[model samples]
Target: MIDSRHRRARLGLVSVTALWGVTFSLNQVALHSMGAATLTFLRFLVASLFLLLGFGLRRSFWQGVNRAELLGGLLTGSLLFGGYLTQTEGQRFLSASLAGFLTGLSVVLVPLILLVLHRGLTRRQFGATLIAAVGLYLLARPQGHEGLLGIALLLACALFFALQLVAVEYYRITTAAVIRFTLFQMATVTALAALVAMAPGGGGLLPLHASQEAWATVAINGVGASALGFMAQTWSLRWLNSIEISVIYSLEPVFAALVALIALHQREGLAVWIGGIIVVVAMVLVSITPPGGATYPQESST
Candidate 1:
């Protein structure tokens, strides 16, 4: 039963990554209309509202709220917000290839952070991390000398993302409370994005002139990526560990490239294909290798 639950969680998390990949491609169309923060505000605003309407109707959902869920949601949301903020600002000074590679560095950060916290690590985990790191570099094919500021910002983005994964596992948020927990996260990002949108030189909450396509992209990402994607991620955490989750997330770029290739008719070089394959191998390694020690007990369904 444990193995079965883990397999299901892995599949669900992979689906979330694929959803993110689709949205990542769509963001190019939306960015032409508004700043990242402005787009973020609208996306999460839609997400929070959608969650409220979908689950708020249940009185039991309200009763599930507790201090742990609130605090867990706040920490995870803030870390998530930090990741977005850094990645968005970092792109200004770095190439997309470099930024993506750095963002995916969370896969490496997760293991390192776990080690620092006295968590167990197996040879398989180390090998997979090394392989995935190589795959990311080849895939990104970063050119030119990157600036210190951009590198720092994206690395910080990786750290925030890594910490958020750790926080999710540590919290052990229950399945029954996942909806409430995710709602808090959505609301927190929504509120923070609103603040960023209103800050000096923020370009305001709404764009001066947004295309219909842009608005439509926001709506799709809000429902599919932000709302459903996050809820699925939180629930999956009951079975998957922080390290496993981060490694699975490395598939995001591969999925993004595939989506672009299929939908946008974008072409990739041989190196891109090779790198993507290597990343997949890494994911398979994680799935098959037995963990070395107990981290957290898997939470059973309610």
Candidate 2:
């Protein structure tokens, strides 16, 4: 079971989760300050630089890369971007906490995707999913159904995130040695987002020069959150079960909610507090329980 490797991977997973948990608020700040497309571009562009320069220095950095591998990278990157695009668009209306919880719904959506694929899920995964669903409800109760648009976008993001997970799980490409391929995927996303950002009537293309805070946010996201966070996430996925990934990811909202309350001074209603507790409990169980009773690579290189 590669026990030593698995332990390191899990540690990486936790690190990734910690950073991502707070990113929901960070993302919201970025969306408000810059065009979504531009913000997205900068995140990946900076990440690409890190990956390229860091790995490029090593001999045979592209040793395992090929057109097919690049394509797989592109697919994974696209799915990731789709999740972000839906998420950013949804944020125009949704609270960051609500959106973060809804996005974590990918945990439930993934097993469902497996069911449709005829691969199906073990009873354990299904059971864990049901509990998570109840947690999701607590976190997502709407106000008289008036928040439908945001809900729909959140749901869409969840579904895409699930697809991304599945793609990464089955992807036969060298999960490591991904620097070149990751760059390809990042470039595609950046190009597409830039075009969309520039389109007339789109979120006005250029970045906001007036807000240096926004630039700082963008730099932080690119370096700390997106690039570094995702490298950990992808690496952890190599050793961890999807359930573990989901459990850790569930923390993103819990952490985001806390950050909002402590740092942003946001108030929470009773329902939010109750729901938050439920989600935290569920995440704790899911993390400790494991799927099929198992435990993720997870080096900085990923």
Candidate 3:
């Protein structure tokens, strides 16, 4: 039964990654009419509302929320907001395929971050990181000034995402109430994004100039990618460690590439394809490798 539960969690995480992958193309479309800040604000606003409505239906949800959880949510949500903001901004200057590849650097970053936090890395993990680093260099081969800038921004996004993943694991260990924790994090992200949108010289809070297509894209991403995706991820982490989650999430770029090909008729160069394959292989290694002596917290269903 325990193994079956873990398998179910893995499947849920796969679904979340696919949803996130499609959002790359959807976000690119929405960004055509809306600024990054405005789009992020509206996206998380819708997501937070959906989460609130769903969780509010249960009395236990409210009782589960407290000051400690809210504080934890603020930290994790800030990291998450940084990641999304940088990724969205970077996507403006990169192809959806390239953006997806660059963002997947978080998979490489995760092990390094864990190492710094005193988690022992196996020889295999070190080799996988080296392989992934080479893949990133090839995948992000400079196309010029704009492309370099996009890659740099996406690297920052990867760093922020790595931090957010580690933070989520820490919070999960302490709190164990996945639904309440995710709800608060979503609310925090919504508030932060709204503030950015309303800031001086930033876009307005509402995407007033956006078209019907843009709105539809945002709505789909907000509900499917942000709200449901995040909740699913939080729940999955109950059964999976941070490294396992990162490895699973590495598949996101493959799904993004597929969506770009089907919807946008996009194609990358030969070098990019080879580099992407290398990165995927590295993630596969990480996934197949058994865990070391690191002390992962006990799995929780709540």
Name the best candidate (by TM-score). Answer: 3
User: In each prediction, how many residue pairs overlap at the backbone (N, C-alpha, C within less than 3 A)?
Assistant: 0, 2, 0
Return the TM-score for candidate 2, rounded to 2 decimals: 0.83
Mark the regions of model 1 whose C-alpha exceeds 4 Å error after superposition: 1-3, 90-101, 120-142, 145-152, 173-176, 265-296, 300-302
Estimate the Cα RMSD of every predicted model relative to the unseen true structure: 3.5, 3.5, 2.1
lDDT of 3 by residue, 1-302 (tens): 24886888889999989988998898888888998988888888888889878776788777756576788889988998999999999998888988888888888888788787886777887888789888878887855679888889999999999999989888787774776787777788889988888899668888678988789987887888888888887777777788888888999999999999898888889888888889888876754535464334577546
Candidate 1 lDDT by residue in tens digits, 159-202: 99888877777776443367777888888888998999899987
Off by over 4 Å in 2: 57-59, 121-138, 142-146, 172-176, 279-302
Span of ten consecutive residues with least summed lDDT in model 1: 287-296
Name the lDDT of candidate 2: 0.67
TM-score for all predictions? Answer: 0.82, 0.83, 0.93
The Cα error of candidate 3 at residue 285, in Å, is: 3.0
What TM-score does candidate 3 get on C-alpha atoms?
0.93
**CA lDDT of each candidate?**
0.74, 0.67, 0.83
Q: On a 0 to 1 TM-score scale, where does candidate 1 land against the true structure?
A: 0.82
